[model samples]
Target: MIGVLVTFAQTGKFDRSTLAKIAGELRGPFEGMAGLRFKSFMLDEEGGQARNFYAWDDEEKARSFFTAELVEKVTGIYGAPPTIEYLDIVGFVDNSGT
Candidate 1:
């Protein structure tokens, strides 16, 4: 599995509602993405940040979302370029039983 962490740091003061909007807007496009096993949306009001954590069965498919154009678009909205980190998944425990 491939683990990707994408975080957007707000370049200014913000509120909880803004965080909610960020979470919704940013996550909308990647919902039900191909090769995505699972995704989690995160918001940190005090930290003024929004994040998306994804588990992918295919790294190539995950990488496809971080195109240069998309990066520019995201930066336009977030006020700063997003910090994207790709990590190896040594192990994961899922008791959800889906």
Candidate 2:
């Protein structure tokens, strides 16, 4: 598995409501996306940051998804560029079925 962390440092550029609306609007497209295990949208209003954590079944798909065009589009939507980080997912625990 692979983990992609996308962070947007708002610095007062965007508000919580706007970010939440963006997340709500965008969630539908990712619902059954291929090669995506899960995607989480997070925000820290006090810290002035919004983050998205994506878990992918493979690195290739994850890498391919975050292209320049996608970044540009997201930047336009969020009103700021993001700092993207790819990480090796060593382990995880899923208790959803419990």
Candidate 3:
């Protein structure tokens, strides 16, 4: 599996409610996305960072999502370019069902 970590700095622009709203808005684009296994939306309120962890079926689709247009959009939202990291998903565990 391919794992992607997309991190953006979120300062005063997005409060908790607004962040939740943005997350909700993104759900539509993520839904029914081919090769997307799962996505985790994260917030580091203290550090002022918004993060997204995406597990994909392959590298191609993972890279495909980070297009030029997407970079521009994210930059506009965050007021800067995002820090993106792509890694191989070597291991994992799921306890959400419990």
Predicted model with the maximum TM-score: 2
The all-Cα superposition gives candidate 1 an RMSD in Å to the true structure of 2.2
Error of 1 at 68 (Å): 0.4
Model 3 scores worst on lDDT over the 10 consecutive residues at 10-19
RMSD of each: 2.2, 1.2, 1.8
Model 3, 1-98: lDDT tens digits are 99999888855544577668778877888888899999887777887878889999999999999999999997886665789999999998889899
Order the candidates by TM-score, highest first — what do you get? Answer: 2, 3, 1
lDDT winner between 2 and 3, please give it: 2
lDDT of 1 at 21: 84
Instruction: For each of the candidates, give the backbone clash count.
Output: 0, 0, 0
- Candidate 3 stretches with Cα past 4 Å from truth are 10-14
- Off-target runs (Cα >4 Å) in candidate 1 are 26-28
What clash pairs does model 1 have?
none
- What's the true lDDT of residue 62 in model 1? 77
lDDT of 2 by residue, 17-39 (tens): 88789989999999999999999
13-84 per-residue lDDT for model 1 (tens digits):
556686678767767666776788888877767787777788998778879868999889878876778899
* TM-score (C-alpha, index-matched) for candidate 1: 0.78
